[model samples]
Target: MADKRPQRGATLNRESNRFNLPERTADGDWLDDQAGIDGAPPRLRTSVTVERARTIISRNTSPDIGFDRSINPYRGCEHGCIYCFARPTHAFHDLSPGLDFESKLFAKPDAPALLRAELAKRGYSAQPIAFGTNTDPYQPIEAEWRITRGCIEVLSDTDHPLTITTKSDRVLHDIDLLAAMAAKGLAAVALSITSLDPRIAMTLEPRAPTPERRLAAVRKLVAAGIPTHVSIAPVIPAITDHEIEHLVERAAEAGARSVSFIPVRLPWEVAPLFRAWLDAHFPDRAGKVMAIIGAIRDGRDNDPGFFTRMRGSGPWADLLRTRFQIACRKHGLNRERIVLRSDLFRPPEGPQGELFG
Candidate 1:
């Protein structure tokens, strides 16, 4: 093994160095009198890339996905979850969805303005603007960027219906805005918690807020009269699956009004990235885990169909569904389905002549 440490500011092509990128040097690599390499230090380097969003609303024709339109305030998430399905999206920009997806993030600094303009359109039809469906709108970078906050503020100002899904406790920073919108019945939130195990969370979501802190966010949001839900998404088969019941139960106790789960989805590039993570973290169970995941995914690492992709299929899938339902029923979660009201939408007052007398 040569001293194949990653160089600072150097980006290895994902196509070229798929999984064989080295990190350490072997004794043979060093000359008889030369010293070994220490390698580059692990540090986060973030670049402020701005995107001028062409349109504010993204509509999904797929029936399985709930909402009709969604707005992603940012492209690429900084949470750094190894199993993120949104990673491949970076490829569209000629960027590797691997490290670049997490490190080289892009923000729609004009999203708030664009959203207001879109809402003010004369023919615009109102529906809940789903935020954070693709990438977390409230990732750690949000503290500084504030694009998500600004979008929420615009939605609040216009009395537009909105819903958010996020894994960051930093959402607490926007409680004032969210609570104000909730007062008008125009807002709802879903906290995506994958596991409660600190160790697993540390390795799985290295940069995301801790599970306990996220639960605290749930409690705080519910207390503020915001309809809050817990989304235990992408339940990794042999890893975080066992913590499902416990997570839901605790979330219920923490004041989450609804609960939902999505089985792990490994699509395209995500499959190999996930396998590498599994091999590195849980070497012994990596093979067993992949086997079980395949069983749930209908004898494949992934099923790209519209309906069965999110929930998966087969015995393993059925077992997860049964377990989730049983746990939800036992905890009385998602019982009422506190749906957000769309009738309260009001067209923007300042633009599109809506306020003309």
Candidate 2:
């Protein structure tokens, strides 16, 4: 396998002031083919910064999502999934939503302490808190920062119910903490596997672990007595949609207890990013691929309506849903339906009110 690094205009350090395109432009300047730059490509370098977050509890009232509160210990994932919906968030920090979104990462070092403080609040109500809802907490940077692990330690200590959604297998590194939480029905994990094809997975989520490795992680988590689920997320039409059944079946075989899926979403800048990715990797089928996506998204590159956003509305959407349901039934996954119990929540001691009382 080729290194797959030095992708287009991406640079690993500060000295490389000039950017190079996958292919040169007509003007002799480096043109970033991925960003659709036909002229001179901008010279940019990836820089990582850390910010102290005031609060870790993110509240969500959307009827579409399963959990009410979530925590993102990091901002901007290093996994560099082109179709990530959270890419737009980088713009708020004066960063480009393109390469900068992935390379330029930010982590909240104080997340664990803040989480503990929040849980100890007088009015804190216990709901199954979610992790990796915005940016993956287990993204490559977590190894050194340990912020996500620390937050999990807090949850495990307090017996707070929690959920995790991540594409990285690094979650297995904290199995002891997760297993302890799971023993008390306080933890569940959802591994997001976009596709089983290595080639497609590489282009789709360039920095994420291999699909097989993630499945192995699922098996490991299950063997450790942790409840596991698989999310066949961002089901790109005309591309990986064909592997839906196979992927789900494999997940079930790996001991996944539940499964869920979401259609390809091109919210904000993700439309152009995904299109560029398709052109770079699958030039011949980019147009057809996007057409199917638009069909599911109601004739537009994206549909952002609250209810329709997660799962699009149309015949294509219905077909995907039907396929997922059939696969789930075939594998006997999601049949047990073990819902997290909120009644066992106990607020931490000190400034935070008692959660179990």
Candidate 3:
């Protein structure tokens, strides 16, 4: 496979949908009738399908994460990170979690309205709603669809708390909304930065914003008074583990309040996809990389036990934690967790009632 195959990250389109859907195969008959024939398949294109979700907010009781409630404005992230643990979810839609997970996408245009309705429930309580918990809220299509901006507008109008995690610099587009919320202690943001190396970043997360741009976004978000932090998520063992200290230093330079890292987790379909990507891009040390990951994950590809899943176990995990802690101490990061205020929340006027002005 060509190293520079446009901007897509997945190496192959594995048809692993649960229903056992037939795999997609190239058809040269149509190509032959249309143009000068080359057997090479046409470049893949992204397609967005509108998902009119009955509800917008999803609640979870997992012990590993911070927030209990969250929202994913879109499904099937286009950033195309080869190791995204969310990849298995696309299998429910009868699509390949590999290439199809990136090329095909979904948008919830009704998110703002649904959010308003839910918030207006009579006994509803307030808590920080996390965006990009599953898929990115500010993927490229966001520039046109503006679903995330619309949801932020709703949150802003209602004085509700929200947190955003994204790898794209597009979050800066809604700086006005976020900054206003920050002024009231109702907002925070974290940009996921995995590797500082351009080459690794290229194949690892083909379409995400460059590390320089993300750090620049951190500077701008900080300047705007948003409690912006840096998340060095999914620290792929051999591929990106070497850049932990460098990333923390850069995050500090950008004025980030905290810097955190998560050792890579390959839960289901993501494991195969990530392995294929490793074999293709980093063949020299791919075995060593998996060995380290296995060591970190307690001799398994993944450990799904609540707390252990988030903070991997074993000697390698301890080393990563120690290095990250040292880096944070050296840079004075993670001094305090930015706490958003839920007391300020006011439910939006909905069909149920218009109590809030």
Tens digits of per-residue lDDT for model 1, 214-294: 999999999999999999997998899999899989999999998988888888767776776776678899999999998
Q: What residue pairs are clashing in model 2? A: 120-352, 121-352, 346-355, 346-356, 347-354, 347-355
How well does candidate 2 score on lDDT at residue 257?
94
Better of 2 and 3 by TM-score: 3
How do the candidates rank by lDDT, highest first? 3, 2, 1
- Give the winner by lDDT: 3
lDDT over C-alpha atoms for residue 242 of model 2: 96
**lDDT, candidate 2, residue 331?**
90
| Model 3 lDDT tens row, 112-182 | 99998898889999999999989889889999999999999999999999999999999999999999899
TM-scores for every candidate against the unseen true structure: 0.89, 0.86, 0.94
Q: How well is each residue in 20-122 modelled by candidate 2, as lDDT tens digits?
A: 2232112112233546755444443445688978898999898888789999998888788878899878766655566767777898889899999899888
Candidate 3 segments whose C-alpha is farther than 4 A from its true place: 1-4, 17-19, 23-40, 351-357
Comparing 1 with 3 on TM-score, the higher-scoring candidate is: 3
lDDT of 2 at 295: 93
Candidate with best TM-score = 3
